[model samples]
Target: MFRVLHRAGQSHDLTYVVVVIGVVVVHVVLVLVLVIVVVVVAVIGGVEVVLVLVIVVVVVVVVVVVVVVAAEAASAPVPIVLTTVTFLFGERTWR
Candidate 1:
């Protein structure tokens, strides 16, 4: 992905680079959330009752976070992108 972005930047397609980066950030967040949920379930060892409760809570939290982020990003996406990037990359882009 970084390679693609570098190529795009060299070609001067800033719009395409921005779009790809946005899509990647969204996907990375979704995938990370999914992996975490899967790991949590596996560690719980399929306890039927607890599993169902955990799934419900996880779903609700995911939905809420998505909505809130979407709302904020709609107004100014740069901060949102920086936040997600900082989250995934341990490097702060936004102060």
Candidate 2:
């Protein structure tokens, strides 16, 4: 309805235009916010997966290093001895 304003009355079409623009802007902002939230969640989930994988790798590496070092220590021919040492905070020396 494209009705023109009379000389004594204001145009009703102005209010319709403002209402339509407001509705459109609100819908656009809501959709943009939804997209941003989804993207953020996906990024956080991806980071969590990477962190879990890194932890698993570190654990496996530590296990392998310990096994190798133990094997080497067992195979060594030299005898190891413990000596007593004193610390600054304690009067007792290590036995």
Highest-TM-score candidate = 1
lDDT of 2: 0.43
Q: What is the TM-score (0 to 1) of candidate 2?
A: 0.36
> In model 1, how large is the Cα lDDT of residue 94?
45
TM-score of each: 0.40, 0.36
Winner by lDDT: 1
lDDT of 1 at 72: 64
Root-mean-square deviation per candidate: 9.7, 33.6
User: What does candidate 1's lDDT look like per residue over 27-95, in tens digits?
Assistant: 778678767776787777666745775678678867976886787678753445554565456453444
Task: Please give the CA lDDT of all the candidate structures.
Answer: 0.66, 0.43
Error of 2 at 4 (Å): 14
**lDDT for predicted candidate 1 compared with the true structure:** 0.66
Off by over 4 Å in 1: 1-46, 76-78, 91-95
